[model samples]
Target: MAAERRHAQMNSYSDIELFSLATQFQPANYIELLSTSSVSTLVGCGQLCNQNVKCRTFDYDSYSFMCRLFEGAVETGSLVPSGSSTSLVGAVRFQPNLFAAFGQDCVQCTNSRYLICSSSNNNTCQCPENTIWNGVKCKNQGYEDANCSNNQWCRQDVEYRCNNMTIIKTDLPGNDLMWNTTANFSMCCSWCGNHSDCKAFTWISSPGMSFGMCYLKWSRGGGGTINPGYISAYY
Candidate 1:
């Protein structure tokens, strides 16, 4: 029964270490709390998450026998006390290496074959070969995390632009993150959000500077510019 149930589910994460071990979370703090249900085991809870593309992580509380599915990547801040390290377990969704065939049941790709699913043998997910699973569906490689410059994958409607990079306060400096040639404003934007002192940042595109430039700031500075070559935002 267990194998039959697991045979149809798709998964995102393989490592338990990627999850938050010290703290538990609440629905209000997350970007979106997708769903909740009573489940029998940790694997059962995870299956629910694998079935949903919008779920970034699944929180299973052994003490309560309840599963929580959330949208958006899990973060550490604003955690609620759930007591005992063994009770509430969180699983961060990763990019899957297997795929479900076209018209195959993505929700049913739960079989434990790792990379292959065959319809003839009664497999849950039907795939031509091993590839990448974008949580809910199969996706081609290199396109899992959306490119911020080309398209706002996470926040499509919003983009901050213009300005030279500088801190709002003279006494503080932004985080020590630097720019990498392959990364764009997306990663820089993430750095600012995670930094303790960074309240804002200005990311100059490759054309604007010699390479991508991320100027982390302690606060949003008074600005006046109309350059399409850069992006600025408050963390």
Candidate 2:
């Protein structure tokens, strides 16, 4: 009877491929917490696991109504039965795009790029830095003067322009500011653009200086400091 009930429950997950529903099975590692809600059924638990990119398996506790998501593979000997029955759902397949066939669900690309799953039944990879996704791969977009053309640098509505040797500062003291050292002026612009809160940036370099410093500012107000060693831009 218990087996029949489990089979009925598993059949409801037409989209997922269930591994097992043992009495007390648990996955090896817990990568992240996807979601927790008033889930009381195995199908509900399976749906939660399927929606998360990082979740490979899930364990549902009937008594506490808790859903735990896990990543990685389940070991052979790790499925031990405990006193209570914990439904373990595992191994979902994902079809990212028409070009790529069904593959194991993955949270990220193997090359450390961000995974973008589309609602149009496709999934693609994105490069976070100043890189371009050339359909098949990611390539360096390069820098323009002191500005970077990477999509990750600025928001969709914001535009950043580069100046060779200029600086803009505000009279308002204690404005949120951050500074970091970069290999060159181009990297300084790239670094500043990557930040969501960065409204403007300046790259500073003195005579014979090999490396430059990037200053990220919250505002683009003028009349504060103008120096020959600084190049400023706004986003």
Q: What would the TM-score be for candidate 2 when compared with the true structure?
A: 0.33
Return the TM-score for each candidate structure. Answer: 0.41, 0.33
Q: Which candidate is the best by TM-score?
A: 1
Off by over 4 Å in 2: 1-14, 31-37, 75-77, 94-235
Count of clashes, each model = 10, 1
lDDT for 158 in candidate 2 is: 21
Candidate 2: C-alpha lDDT: 0.47
Model 2, span 103-148: residue lDDT tens: 2233444432124333343444343333344464333342222233
